[model samples]
Target: MASVKVMRMKLGSEGLDVSAQGLGCMSLTPYYDQPKPEPDRIALIHVAADLGVTYLDTSDIYDNHTNEMLIGKALKGGVRQKVEVATKFGVSFENGREVQGDPAYVRAACEASLKRLDIDCIDLYYQHRIDPRVPIEVTMGELKKLIEEGKIKYIGLCEASASTIRKAHAVHPITAVQLEWSLWARDGEAEIIPTCRELGIGIVAYSPLGRGFLSAGSKFSENPYEDYSVLSLPRFQPENSPDLVTAFKRVSRITQAKGCTPLQLALAWVHHQGNDVCLIPGTTQIENLIENIGALSVKLTPEEMVKLESIASADNVKCSRYISSRATGESSCTPPPSSWKAALKRIFFYG
Candidate 1:
């Protein structure tokens, strides 16, 4: 058997070492809408770590804390010391639907996560979603305290704007900023990448495979009932939309022509974005996890990079990534004019 591959990067001035590619644990526990059994989820995580995946991501709200507990179980027996465990707090579910984040709530949330994970300190603790109700500084202040208390070794923010990132960095050195960045979602490249570079903060990209669309498998289609898939996005909708299918096909054609899987192409693209950028595409299957980790070896030549850029630009991607309203709630880009055509996208993400 091939040895597990290791991908590593440094977080800003802190110089904390992290994986070049990580695992997102949310899907393992069914944070999206459904639930995967704890045994299966824990087994999958152990397989990732056994395969040399060092960076693992989870959030407090996932399966209402089940994800963390699952990870804690898997990390016992010294497995925790062998890898980096990154988890997020903040963004609570109210009425079983809405997510709320407040500064006070953030402080309390971190403590709750620490207890559940059963760790002396978190390798990296992130603010899962920006709480618009509180200033970025106030929210960051709570994180800074955690770091001071040795509860967290590093701080990160997910799905935050460049401006918010700047404010948070001023409060304390932000080691990494997690964002959704894939071939299908390029909004973060515009301003977010530049900001991270300027501040010396590392970029940790989630959904680097376009949530499996870029992989060498079935295309993303909708089930009016299966809310968790890409089809729920306004852009993926077959109506009132620009030609997303055409673009996806174009991506397929380009990657196929390159003699590589779309997932490999997409991951290579993310890796090429910058030296400080890292990717964390999650998968439950051991084969898929191994395949994604193999992306570290798929280097793209300068000419090939140009080819991909040209094809993607020519495709003129259309549609909103998340539900139109939530899309605006936490991004730098403007939603499409027809965003109102869709309702809150329901992705049946059960881990």
Candidate 2:
């Protein structure tokens, strides 16, 4: 196997730098399916580091805090200095669900994450989900306090709207904005992406493989999401899967020609979008982890990029964020007019 050497990218103009692509640690716990043994998970992280994957993303709500602990344990034996670990603090269990971004809750949540991760300071800290109840400034204000106290080195937001992004940035320089960004989910390109570009906030493309849908295609009878019940989600349903597969055929032609998998094709497109973008593709298996990093080797020509753009147009992406898993509901992700007249989008995220 060729040695992997992942480069680094700067997050906005905040002087923050991290690995070009990050390892999404969400699947290390049972939230995805069956959790791996503690030793296996730690070994995977170590292997990822050896492969030059040093930017790790985790959240407090992932398996009720086990994900952060998993990363922390892997970073032990003086390994923490070798990598940059990013974690979130906005979401906490409340009333049997998530309540996030409150000022008081923000302070408390950061403290709890710090204790769990067994770290003195988090390299990157994000508000997992915006709390509609609080103003953007209020949330950013609390994040600013954390920065002042040296708790977190940089601030990031997940699933934020353009207006909210501007308001929050006015309070403090946001280092990055993360969203479900992939060929299958291009809604963010309409507004949030442009806004991030304007504000110099880096784009962290989470689920860049469309929750494994864009990556797996129809090759496997076993539902990759079987453990998480992602099959129950509208976008992953049998009816929608056909549209996704058809939309990907054009890109599939390119991947076949290049001898790459759909996963690498999707990741290279994200990497080429701009310097402002980075991706966190997650996997539970070591082989898949190495496969994802292969994306770094698949470069697209200008014409190939244009072909990908047409394939990823709003019209081609056929599903919405959270359409009712039931058949009666309609899909919201169908492409809008050349103008972005789509309904005002609110961040609809669950843990």
Deviation (Å) of 273 in candidate 1: 1.2
Flag regions of model 2 displaced more than 4 Å. Answer: 220-229, 324-351
Give me the displacement of residue 264 in model 2, in angstroms: 0.7
- Candidate 2 local lDDT, residue 201: 93
Per-model TM-score, in order, reads 0.86, 0.88
lDDT of 2 by residue, 238-343 (tens): 5555555677677778899989988899998888888778899998889988888888888899898888888877565556655431134565444233312212
Report every candidate's CA lDDT: 0.73, 0.79
Candidate 2 lDDT (Cα, 0 to 1): 0.79
Instruction: Report the number of the highest-lDDT candidate.
Output: 2
